[model samples]
Target: MTTQQDIPGRTVYIVSDGTGITAEALARSVLSQFNLTFSRIHIPFVDTLDKVRQAKDQIQAEREKTGQLPIVFSTLVIPELVTELRKADALHLDVIQTFVEPLRAELGISPKEEIGLSHQNMESLEYKKRIEAINFTLEHDDGQSNRNLEDADVILVGVSRSGKTPTSLYLAMQYGLKVANYPLIPEDFERGHMPKALQPYKNKLFGLTIQPERLAEVRNERRPNSRYAALDNCRYEISEAEGMMNLENIRYLSSTSKSIEEIATAILSNLRSY
Candidate 1:
């Protein structure tokens, strides 16, 4: 059995240790288990012996300053590398990687069994290709196939800089939805109405707009130094486009400065509420 003693104030170096994001997430989760407050240093991508030694030297310097030996926990550790790190002379240290050896004794599961379980989980995933195909058809069918937009789980319409592609992609990927996105062109804006293509699907259609400055920034990243990316042009186009959406009493979301996860989750929440 491994025992961890309480230290009032200690620092920990949570090395990615080749486990990448998964290791960092684990470290964040375990932070509440200890009574003591500590600083967490994330050392990412520790792949070799040289990297391990460098990490030890860094911890060595920190320990010397703090007068408390740092607790080093890593997702990757080998016996030979462990021997090298211990010689660095840090104090009151706990190396948690060595505790993994008890997994076979406690879990009573083999590596092959674990692998098989993962494979089985993946295999059970339902066929989603049909859903994707339906979505793609809506976006690219060019009005030739005459697919019914009313049947879509969600419909998206906005001027070009709006959050259509990403939001539609998220809905399709996450909820197995048939999604369609249509760009409101200048003519549609001038007409002060929903695009004819979207008129029939008015009930399912959604709009995404952005602050002109934010819209310009997003466009500039894709096409720098062009009229499409110019701030004033973005402002004019966005105002006209939004005015058109409003003329029809269409509802919209402001997508500027929101993360993909936030947008997707918000869209899902709205759909669920309806």
Candidate 2:
């Protein structure tokens, strides 16, 4: 029943003994639903007593400045470390203990609380799959190597810097997908068709396009004062690329205001349909 007017400015801290990615992601996912201004900070590698004390001191300072309790989201697996962080004057959300205790009771066994074990299991089969996917993604970047296009789970096509590379890498690393990306250039545009190399894997193809102004801005950072980065050229490429995608019945998405995570999820959802 909390309304936007009921929300107030606050501070949020994501504390963890490892990379802090889990704690931060949980905090953002929960906080994104509320309309409030949050000053966020991440305290990572707090695996010792000294680091815990330092983090507690920071929380105290922020509470004094704001005249209210700050909100803390933590994923510390060590009992002693979690105990120390709980002493801070804030609304502490123990992200791990919240579910770990129930699961431990259900299984009637003490949980082996290890830090970063979720991602550090390099010897596991899942880890090997992710590594292989990353290697395949790198080898086929930007249409450099098409010898293995048939092995790709998905092939991304778009004009240069339309988020093809990062999206492809994210798809590979996060989903264990073999992703290959190709950049559509003026030569392809002149031909008025999709790349001939991609015709064989038409079902695996997904296209990305961006606003011409935004595309030009991104390209200008790499090659300033050149025709390749000119706004008119960007506009022309986007127009032709989108037109070709539609005419060829290839699915496409716009990357103008969407995050890589959102774009990748959409691509995966589409892939499921086929």
lDDT scores of the candidates, listed in order: 0.67, 0.91
Instruction: Identify the candidate with maximal TM-score.
Output: 2
- Put down candidate 2 lDDT per residue, 49-122, tens digits, no spaces: 89999999999898788677889999889898888988888999999999999999999999887766666487
Which pairs clash inside model 2?
none
For model 1, residues 1-274, the per-residue Cα lDDT tens digits are 1235435556778764454455556666677776657777878666567987898899888777766677766655455555666666554233344454577568885332111121123334443554554556446432333266666777777778688877777777656677777777767766767767777777776778889888888888999988988899888888887887787777778888897767778877777776
Tell me the lDDT of candidate 1. 0.67
Measured over all alpha carbons after superposition, the RMSD of each candidate to the real structure, in angstroms, is: 8.9, 4.0
